[model samples]
Target: MTAQILDGKTLAQRLKGQLQTWLAEVSPQVGRPPGLAVIWVGDNPASAAYVGQKQKSCAQVGITSFGGQFPAHTSQGELAHLIQQFNQDERVDGILVQLPLPADLDSTKLLHTITPDKDVDGLHLVNLGKLLRGEPGLQSCTPAGVMRLLGHYQIPLAGKQAVVVGRSILVGKPLGLLLLASDATVTFAHSRTPDLAGLTRQADILISAVGRQGLITPQMVKPGAVVVDVGINRTPAGLVGDVDFVGVQAVASYLTPVPGGVGAMTVAQLLLNTVQSYGQRHELVMPQFSG
Candidate 1:
């Protein structure tokens, strides 16, 4: 059978519809729409695209998004001050600072300064700690999006041999944690892993987050394994995922496409997180997505 394309863009559109309905229900009680603040410190094209998509998703869901753009040379102190101000702003329920900040900026310190409640990115140590402890907290959007895709497709995770490639705090580490929470036996592989393809072949659930071009080929995937490609690499051929899609599609049972799969769900989950964060802060419970 030809592998089913996990259409994240379509899924995102449906999820955004749910967000609109949820917002409509709660806006009356809250007396305002949920708000999201996105702060970008530099002019990186890719990051700008990601932030713009996020803001657009917010608008589609009827959430008020405040976009803050800062100069490339903006100091760490200035950035922290903006975060502090957002933390205190009653109108802003979620705060996101775009990643891969300027080379000289202290990303760790900047993440730590955001109030844990408003940490919509789920990068704060406290939030990460909560996830590691299997508690209910805002989860990282990309991983959360991956889970939504898996659930939508009804791919079982319990007792599965899952492998996550890459160890970045953003995608790999937290995604591994989420898989473990679902009762999957998780193994995390990095660039240093010897014979990466061999480890990949053992996975029942394979996720590639390594930011390299066509890093996962057909030979690396086991027959009928589920593959999720999370990389966003730009090349002359256009956007490419970690997995070499043409090759792996022949071998994998399920696969996510680069431009339309994980990427779309990521923004969808960001909007979900913003609404969820708003509900949590105000002691209101939003209806879970029943789709």
Candidate 2:
């Protein structure tokens, strides 16, 4: 049977429409639009593309942009000072530092400088802690986007065997905690995990966030399992996800495409997180969308 596509591109568009409506409704009361500051360090092409997409989405949803690109040699103290400036800016609701910072700059240290309330990227430990405790908080965009996609399709999560391949703090670890919060029995596999196929074959819901293309082949997937490929790899063939999409499509019951799937939803969730922060700052009730 051909797999049903988990079309994140379409869903993200719909979510953006909803956000636009919400922003229109609240901007009058708040007297200002919600704002997002996306700080990009260095000139990484991928990071630049991602930041551009985010800023464009912000404008579409009436969120103001309070950010700019930084030089490659910008110092940690300089970046930290900028983050603090955004944190204190009443017009700014979210602050995000683009990743793969210049080799000398400390990403972790800079992340800590952003106020937790305005940390829309949800990489701050405070928000992650809230997620671990199953409380309401801004979540990492990609993982939060995954959960939102599954919920939208009304996929079963309770008591399912969910395997998350890759244990990065950015995606895997937090995503596993999210699935666990949904009552899915979660196991994390990484580079060192032995017999990887053996673990993946048992998953009812398989999520691969590792950047390695073609990592999850058809043989490794359980028949009829839901496969979400969060990987974005630039290959000889252009862009591809972690799963061998053509092969796995013949086995899995549902799947997400590389560029249009998790990537699209990631930006969508970032907007949602910003709106959430905006609402909190103004003591206004924000619209909450489930599934």
Best by lDDT: 2
Colliding pairs, model 1: none
Residue 53 in candidate 1, Cα distance off native in Å: 0.7
The 10-residue segment with the lowest total lDDT in model 2: 282-291
TM per candidate comes to 0.98, 0.98
Estimate, for each residue in 1-291, the C-alpha lDDT of model 2 and write its tens digit. Answer: 678999999999999999898788879978999999989988898898899999999999899998899899889898999999999999999999999898898999999899999988888889889998999888999999999999999999999999999998899999999999999999999999999999999999999999998899999999999999999998777789999999999999999998899999999999999999988888986666542
lDDT of candidate 1 at residue 42, scale 0 to 100: 89
Score residue 34 of candidate 2 by CA lDDT.
91
lDDT agreement of model 2 with the native = 0.92
C-alpha lDDT of all candidate models, in order: 0.91, 0.92
Give the worst 10-residue stretch by lDDT in candidate 1: 282-291
Inter-residue clash pairs, candidate 2: none
- Model 1 misplacement above 4 A: none
